[model samples]
Target: MEPDQVLSVTELTREIREVLQGHIGTVWVEGEISNHRLQGSGHQYFTLKDAGSQLSCVMFRGARSGVRLSDGAQVQVHGEISVYEPRGQYQMVVKQVQMKGQGSLQARFEALKRKLHEEGLFDQDYKQDIPKYPRVVALVTSPTGAAIQDMLNILTRRAPWIHVLVFPVRVQGQGVEKETIRALEMLNRAEAHGLPVPDTIVIGRGGGSIEDLWAYNEESLARAIFASQIPVISAVGHEIDFTIADFVADLRAPTPSAAAELLAPDVTELKRHFESLSRRLGGQVMTLLDRHEQTLDFIARGALKTAPAYQLQTAEQAVDDLEDNLKVAAKEQLRGLGDLIQERQQIIVEHHPRIMLMEAAHRLENQAQQLQQKISHKLERLADQVTSRAQLMKHLGPESILARGFSYTTDAQGNVIRDAADVEPGQTLVTRLQQGQVTSTAV
Candidate 1:
């Protein structure tokens, strides 16, 4: 505060930067991006502007983690305000970036929405239908918030005895997303632990700013909602508020009261419906009975013929005819029995002892003749084969040649003498004739 005090340009800039950083911290500023430029150092420089004002901003490549934006696009910059000493200018050093106009919360929400939507998390086929009258309704939200009370009141007014369990959660601030996810998973586990499991769940909180509602927009909560075994109803904020949880839930209720209405049927209306159904059923049953009674009356009126005596006479005539038929049948049976007896007598005569003996002797003679023929045929085949073999032996062996008066001469050693040099002078030789072997001396 002294007038004699002097400050260097660098010092002044540094001081101003510190003041801005302390006051602004990391603030979110929304505007359209213009003069967007990328540097070789993997950093981006841009100016954020609106219809009335513009602000300088710089974002390092690390902060550009999502879809890239062009110059004419609206965006939001989350960074700290700082003064650049060299340029003597003030700017926001962007730490994070997202599309603007849709709001930072909405931008992140839509991005996550697109990702999960592509994953089929928001597909109608994957969603289960909410029960018209759920036995147990679980509310995953702040227990003390107005939303819970509103839901409880609506449920009580509609279905008087329907059960409601309030599971408390942090719906805003840091770690809110995790807490919400935990509540959902815990309820799912309740059934396995022999505790009450909800048939349907209503998860949300009362309306607030986009920041306050950001927990419902988290990707983790969206995934958890998709995975819940029970059908979920998203009842966050008022009729105008929308979140990622709403899109992913099986049913989306504009308000907590509306969700309660969806889960529980109106008792008065249900009773009226039952009564109407009962009346209709009773009417149908009565009509059927009346029709059956009319048929019975008609049948009773025609139980007997108009001339009952004539009908009785006709029945008597039929009995007489049956008796006559029985008598004729008995006579025919007697005739048939007589014929059968005659046939038996003829068969007995034919089966006498002498006749049976003659038949047996004839069969024996025929069998002997057949056996003799088989034996003769077998002997002829054997005789032919024996003669053929004998002829072959005579041709192949020396017997035929010997019988033709030819003889074989062998030396004393039993080797046949094919040449004169094989025989020695005065050596005994064996000369085999047709009938015998002769001994002779060789000169």
Candidate 2:
């Protein structure tokens, strides 16, 4: 171990390996995986790298963790630091591997997605319909980014008529969600904010990592997009990226340029459409005018123009026929009136006053006899009813009750004493029997 002792290449590598294993030992490292390779022998080799440095790592067949090992995967590895003696290189002998920072962000994304979905924010019923032709469009994006430039170019090229309102906002970093949300609010109540109301609002940003695009995934931003009166088009990141804003927005465009293409109708295509319509209209008008001109030509060359005297003679004959037909119709009408008058006279004779008076007299005589019979019967029935009522009254009279031996007692004032409590012990009393009245006084 002395400085004078010479060491072979193998010995030096073995010594270095020992030093790394004993000193660095087993430790955990987090980085993005790159140049990942899975050997046919079931061993995996990869490089773990960050911004400044890279470390070679290898996981043997036996230590193969079930976690997916792929390039660009952000992962944390647990292993012992060791040097490969044969290659004279130091590397980590990885024992375990798992996802790192991106995994937690993904988990948060999924959880927020579930919460908003359960709240009906992602429901199609709540999604506003994007106008087919937006007159005014508000772009909420970073003015300095490639996204805004791409959108403006597309909007200007496709629909030059569209009024573009650019409300610059931070599309990334902390508090970006609040800025995006504020832009949406201003665009929704644009008139109140003294800004022209936009028919559509486009929230867009260039492609980035999930962390960079995390602002669009914010719950508040998603809710703001859901609450927006103006339809929102979410164009965050690439086509593969999905955020909560994409799910809650009225429409999801794959990119910022795609959102512009959707909002702005191509001027050339619209012009072609209008030109086709104009051609069709013009053809129809020409066809109608030609038809009317043909009719006029036929009239100009017809018999009415070429033979005026013959036409006039035919008109005189037609008038003569009409006069004769009117004569016949008038004679028939007079005959009908004469028959109607005769029928009326016959009806009047049948209904003469003398005949009606005789019939009335006969009916009156018969009615008089019936009236006398009804009056006699009524008087008899009334007499029977009176006799029965009189008998009933006699049976219920007070004289009949006195003859039945019922008696009554009264106080000196001649008031009937029903209850004994109503009379005084020393007061005068009169007892009325069926035949006589008895008077008594206190002793």
Candidate 3:
């Protein structure tokens, strides 16, 4: 037995605080809170209590300002151990405090969600688009759960021809994370092998409390959903119950039944679309046939219905009628034009002269005839005058006088003697008579 040492309260508390300080500096304590108050300085003063004990907690203004706390709220606290010398007691200096139980789990979930979001793992770019028409669909869930049953029922009702593959997996509890990862890997392996691979995968479970749905919130499971090659539809819990898997999956359905409806097509809608297309095609074909028949009827009633010789005879008759009409019109027009010209000529004659041009031509011809008669008479007169003048000149000639009474005597050279003194006694002489000249010698 150790002997007890009596000491003052200050020393006793100081020793106690020294022992508590080491242990409390790094420990997690869980309790329900009370007497929570915010001081004027913005520090928090609260009491942590349990069924058998209570503890005083002080969060300073700097450390507790952003912390939201309330009375009767459950919490887990972490802090260092210290003693206020003035108060003469030991207390915890809280570094951090968090809501306990399910609230803590929710906070962790939100943190991881934001982290994965920043990495683009939960982005639409990473999500696979659901196939418009899935030929083979793979389902991942508890084999005995109602979710699987609902999905199977919906798939059969919507598209009976679609093939279904079941990959049994645990939807809750301890080993679920590995099973989910395994199931996705199996689907990928089947696809790589060219074996029967599912076009879409439905991964989900029925609704429950958050604890029952915690496995879906695991980061490992979320990563598996992100890495899957096939498009995934998450249908965990009811509509309001969301999990990390929902954000990472390609699609989120409100319920398990809705997920099945989304995975398959609507039979009634497809039938309606097919009927509309058929009606349009039938109408087009009928319209084409009707137009073809109309064209054929038009060709049958054309000019080819008549004989070639009859057509030629009709054309020739038309030409003859046209020629006769043209000739009649031309004759009438010519008669009218001639009457108009004659009328115009008569009017001109009455206004001016009856034969202006004819009178002028007659005058010209008469003048020409008078000129010819005058020219002929003048020529005959000129000829008679010329003969008389010539006869007078010849009768008065010197040779005529010589022939009458005198002789023109000349020498032997035949020169005439004009005077008696020109004669010589020994010279030969020529005498001019009316008939001829005679040559004689002077004696």
Residue by residue across 1-443, what tens digits does model 1's lDDT show?
Answer: 78668888898889988898888888888888899998999998989999998888888777753447679976677888888889989999998776654454666777888998899888999889998878888898887888888889889988988888888887778988898788889889987767698898888688875667888888888989999998999999989888999999999999888888888788899999999999999999999999999988875776343667776888899999999999999999999999999999999989989999999999999999999999999999999999999999989799889998999999888888889887888999999999999999988
- State the TM-score for model 2: 0.53
Regions of candidate 3 where Cα sits further than 4 Å from its true position: 1-100, 192-195, 296-443
Candidate number that wins on TM-score, 2 or 3: 2
| Of candidates 2 and 1, the better by TM-score | 2
Clashing pairs in 2: none
**TM-score, every prediction:** 0.47, 0.53, 0.47
Task: Report the lDDT tens digits of candidate 3 across residue range 163-247.
Answer: 9998899988889878988998889788566658989888889998667788888899899899888899898999988999999
Off by over 4 Å in 2: 1-74, 77-99, 299-443
Error of 3 at 110 (Å): 1.4
Candidate 1 regions with alpha-carbon error over 4 angstroms: 1-103, 304-443
Candidate 2 residues 355-392, lDDT tens each? Answer: 78988999999999999999999999999999999999
TM-score of 1: 0.47
What RMSD value applies to candidate 3?
39.5
After TM-score superposition, what is the CA distance of residue 423 in candidate 3 from its true location, in Å?
Answer: 99
Residue 151 of model 1: what lDDT?
Answer: 87
